[model samples]
Target: MERPPARTPEGSRKTPVTSGLAARAHRTFTPPELIRNFCIIAHIDHGKSTLADRMLQLTGVVEERAMRAQYLDRMDIERERGITIKSQAVRLPWAAPGRDGKTIDHVLNLIDTPGHVDFTYEVSRSLAACEGAVLLVDAAQGIEAQTLANLYLALENDLHVIPVLNKIDLPAAQPERYAEEIAHIIGGSPDDVLRVSGKTGAGVKELLDKVVAEIPPPVGDADAPARAMIFDSVYDIYRGVITYIRVIDGKITPRERIQMMSTRAIHELLEVGVISPEPIPTVGLGVGEVGYLITGVKDVRQSKVGDTITSAAKGATVPLGGYRDPRPMVYSGLYPLDGSDYPLLRDALDKLRLNDAALTYEPETSAALGFGYRCGYLGLLHMEITRDRLEREFGLDLISTTPNVVYRVTMEDTTTHVVTNPSDWPSGKIRDIVEPIVRCTIISPSEYIGTIMELCQSRRGSLGGMDYLSETRVELRYTMPLGEIIFDFFDALKSRTRGYASLDYEEIGMQEADLVKVDILLQGEAVDAFSAIVHKDSAYGYGVSMTAKLRELIPRQQFEVPIQAAVGSRVIARETIRAMRKDVLAKCYGGDITRKRKLLEKQKEGKKRMKMVGRVEVPQEAFIAALSTDSAPAAGKDAKK
Candidate 1:
């Protein structure tokens, strides 16, 4: 019923082929009509990766002995976290059952995408290379925030969506209910939703057959001028920048001169290949095919994702649509624990950026934390992944400041500035301030609707609309300032709803706000990195809490240290860290009262001298603890004893 696996090389075992051996196996290329470019879209932990693994196994592209869960997840962090951090593409040969009950060979180009809200950009690029998408929904959990989000993206891309209800083998799975929900959301018959179990491989063959029958083949002309879409790329130390491309028209061959439409850069193609889950070198990739190209590109900026690749001699008149640079939603400062490691961190970031084009960073200096980079990311998870990679891969110990969102400030001179870091915030400019706003959507069980609304109200969210998805499930929409949620809103929401609530948000625009900059001063010296912009109404309370937290975190110095929270020249809150008292007269046990007085006075003079000359040493952890706004006991409750 299926084609046999490719013959292993002499003396090679039936295991996963290493990159070298895979390149050596010269394979025949399928015609464009027989090729289907598709991707899997789903919510996090919704069995997208498992379904991909099963597809590869059934197609005989990967041997069962070498089959591990999420075989396409190449990153170690991805495997450890059990999440798909990066989108991966592979080619599989399937023997689809035709109308006459005869088996026909079909080439399937499958791109497995990450299901987190943070990696939505990655999903978009992956979808650009596909003509169809498999929308996987969990039968037990039903729909989620990301499921709808990705479904809309697939529809926007005009891809044929095949709804597959997964995890039906589970005892708790309610396949019928989810099928009805899918039908309601996507406008399909309940019976049309294919039921499958990724764990047991049930209904998988039928799903594949449906893919061949339903999804349309890519349309392109081989005789036309060469035009390809660069969906993704990675930097290799030996081969330089390797770009993954989908050939929409014509063909790309080794030694062919290619030009990037956006950057207007030209290079000779060093190699053309396809990913058999690993790089497999090929002579050329033709129209309606997906593969990779090596062009000796050293700089990642030149090989921008979503850029067009065309023949240098006769380039396309216009680039493809849906090409926009990624804008960061959250900003933070990344400082090396040791300032000398700055260069090492910079180099590591450069290499990492080659793979992650969404990450943005620039050098920034802090008065208290020394030198670091102000980094911007798509979401909180993106920031976490970048930090983890820097520490684990580059072996650098780092400190991160509190995350913040960009704000718009209108000055008295009629000029506006966008501020990402607190130190760069123009507090002296007298005028109005506008903060970014997001349209927040939350879906949860009706029982937790009250709790969700309360949490939203506390975050200054205004209810926009509410709808009942089903009798038990409800979706709520709200408009809220982006600043309120960048810190711990998601964590709080999950805690309040017991992890049943899921959230999705999109930036609406900027709105006028009553805002003020709050500064933290230690011993009358303002710490630049400790400053933050907050609403005027909450400034006083926030200042008091911050001052109290600082008093607890800062260790006692030889001299009394004054911790103050200020708005411009006016101090709003203050706390004092008392000096540690010591017995200088301990040695004089039997001395007279006069002798003791003179010793105490001398000790006092020495203390005064030390206080004037010494600097208070602030621990690195103090900065992190003070800036972290995670829920803690009331400030006075943790007062220093």
Candidate 2:
């Protein structure tokens, strides 16, 4: 391939490219042997992004003048939050000295992944694209729940795991202690763990050297039929859906027709390239290489993550072992604040789904909230970030209901139904109701063990076990109902532990429980949007809190509105929204007793007529305020009482 004119040897951008607007190009493809694919995985705030910054500088893939903190983090939300929500891949060039005393140039395909448990799917997809992982642990903070979780995921994929303790320059750094802890976990000696300071850029060169030497190169049949794995993708308004893929077998080039193995969707490849922190159009991507492909795919759904990409004419016979779909543990109703924005909301979600593959939604309607979609999320944080992106990126005003989990209900005749929305709870169920359960891992200081246990128990969690990561830090395992934790457990856990505790949870099937669907009724009419499914033990508390909250939100109407939270025919709790009073005796203040009596009689008759004719109208703001998670803390307080 011919080099573009006036290009630097490093292939760094010469022209001033706007920040994250478009990828700056770089190129000069290398063979499969010199290519190394790996990722950095750690707990949040453990310096994964900062370390990535240091590597960017060391490799000179992103020049110092243009590079900022978290160069791989392209989203404004990610930069503002100082977190990597999406897994980002970039290609960098390195020249490592070989054992034979010769300097060998290498192509390093580095993927920076999110550490948050909500974005674990992103990490897993990134994992499938690599043959090795750099397990990053904070020297001061030691191993966290996510660090361990991500480590296990890497090991499960049979990838080489390299242990590294970061932040050696911190005042509270305890590299010696954490190195042993990391070694014990990874089945190696403490001396095997590499130490690096991301803040000071200490020991990074050695870490890179270790990566090139220790991690084995990816092996694939170069002459075989073309095959690539679609690990991640983003929707470009100008280019349509751009898929990030890792080539496993054969090579792909521009102008070639390709087929998605899973969906059988075909598109002519418009461009093929590698991201040297930017998209550099390459002649082709060979085996064991990571790059991007532009197929002019408008609908992101057609290019599924974990789907195989192959030549439309001479595709591979079999697809690779793909990823399991990320099951949504939390479900919420996302209604547009304005009714007319419903169509816009759907379109926005569809486009956002291109960038975010884990997002799932279906059309749902509520009498109180109107037209909307019931969206599924991996966790509470995932729900929050996705909603924030929708508002910030697409300019959509979204109102999300309180998060809940799925349930399985069996009827007397043995008919089974899976209920995701509370409003969809089966009415004919007479046998058993089972709710999703999760194995939650909470790591915190030992002093907070009692507080953690108390919080877990309050949420109906059973003690699975407990272990000491160190003398002070302890890991507590609990099996809790997914519904119980999705609402306020994480917030409460953080607050109770003074924000020292880190939590990670994975759904572990379902268990039968005494559960009931609590409905909020306004003047004998059930508001489906405000309904919730709760355990029988906390049914009264949920009902009471919901009714009380609604009473405060819903304005006083012409007729008295009774807000009742009922389970079946039984009303568990009720709050009356009293009617606005009219000063009926104002004209009769100076009149006789008979005149006042007549006025009072007329007023009473009018009240009766109003009650008979008028119905309660719960405003949109009322529904938004009632169903929002802002009521979560209040509900927790009430439930405690």
lDDT of each candidate versus the true structure: 0.82, 0.84
* Candidate 2 per-residue lDDT over residues 322-345, each given as its tens digit: 889888888889989899999999
lDDT of 1 by residue, 1-641 (tens): 99554321111223454333233433555578888999999988899999998887787777666778888887777888788888988887777887789987777889999988778889988988899999999999898878998999999999999999999999999999889988999997999999998998999999988889999999988888889998877776556788889999888888989999988999999888787765667878887888888888787678877888999998887777745678898888999989999999888888788678788999998888888999998877777778888988779988878777898888999888888987878756668888889998888999998999999998889999998888899989999998887666787777788878888777889888888889988878888877888888878988898889889999998778889999999999999999888887888889589998998898789879987888877898897677543332111011100
Q: Pick the candidate with the highest lDDT.
A: 2
Q: What is the number of residue pairs that collide in model 2?
A: 0
Model 2 segments more than 4 A misplaced: 1-28, 630-641
- Which number leads on TM-score? 2
Candidate 1 ranges beyond 4 A from true positions: 1-26, 99-101, 624-641
